[model samples]
Target: MPSYDSWPSPTWKKIIEEQLEQVEQMPRADFDIMLKKQLPMAVYNKELMTGDTLDAYLEPHAGSLGKASFFSHQVAHYNAKYTESYGTDLPKLKVPVQILWGEEDEWQPLMYAKRLVQDIPHACLHVIPKAGHFVMEDEPGQCSDYIDRFCNKHP
Candidate 1:
């Protein structure tokens, strides 16, 4: 059900291979260049945040994000462990489970959420409208409400 239940498709494989090469070379980052790339994709609604907010979000993580070698190592480890149990690793989970996702997620599309719901037993999915990868930032009140409801159900 999950996209990575098997090896990545050729397109992804190519991207991964290219990223591996880039990470190995450990290229020096130009933040100005990177920010241009990051800002456009990071959020669906740029207007929701002030320029200062975006800076605050990106600045602290800039160092970690720049650490290509470390990033590559983690990716390699996860790639090695990829399996059919990828998304449903906790199938027999005893606790309550609810999967909340952004309906308009640019990277992870609707199919991913649908597959996740099918794979995880008893996991209900909530797709927040007009939301992207950053659901909390996109719909804070609704996200909080979902969290609160999940907590209440479990407790």
Candidate 2:
């Protein structure tokens, strides 16, 4: 994805600022609310989040993820540094590369995967069908299989 690009062409700071306000205003830090609000955007399949998976996943890292300042710093850092690194320098990688992406990812679509593969030498992209940004959560078996295959090929 293009650095600091969006539908409205707003910088990363603006988006994070809006989210920071929402996080502060929420009545509870409950995972359920987050699941209802953000999970659809994160996960491609709701079936993968059944039982206590979301709770278990969030409980361990809730504190750090809940921090507004930390999030703001991350957004700023990424927007500031990404263009110089990933956007511009990605093609410099010489080692074998495998891009494992969710095919249904709306945030970063298959085009980004293709772009990465095209730019990086010895790079291949594997798209996990019916999966979104959280590909591991949506299709753990396929994700793991692709990773194992890639590692084995590299090794």
Candidate 3:
């Protein structure tokens, strides 16, 4: 029964350590540098500021948002739905589709890219280095390049 914030903290660490007997892995220095470079562009400053202010406003009235639930539910639902929808016969899309995925994405592994290319008739796959699930956010330039290439080829 760990809360969202606490799940990533001491309780989860102890459980993981006990069950998996795994040591915490520190981020590589280059990864930190890449994160610093990417975070600004990833965050919509105005939206972030607005969301923060709204959170502060709502903090005083905790009951306003209604019943609290496991934060992971939404993510689980989306993942399940995505898998279900894509499991069917692939769409007959004529437009050129580019599947850009991060090599380091834990949520959707690079194998998904290959599966996508196989499923989609005109799909091309691009794997971005040193990126995670949020590939567009992590590698904006690479994402833009993929889009540009797709457009050029399609046109």
Query: Quick one: ranking by lDDT, best first?
Result: 2, 1, 3
Q: Give residue 138's error in model 1 in angstroms.
A: 0.8
Residue-level lDDT of model 1, residues 19-95, one tens digit each, is 75564455446534444454545356767544776766656435645455345554455442465545557666656
The whole-model lDDT of each prediction reads 0.63, 0.64, 0.50
* Per-model C-alpha RMSD: 3.9, 3.9, 11.5
Better of 1 and 3 by TM-score: 1
Decide which is better by lDDT, 1 or 3: 1
Question: Can you tell me which runs of candidate 3 are displaced by over 4 Å?
Answer: 1-76, 79-82
Residue pairs with clashing backbones, model 2: none
- How close is every model to the real structure, measured as TM-score? 0.71, 0.73, 0.50
Candidate 3 lDDT by residue in tens digits, 111-146? 667777787797778888877656665678888988
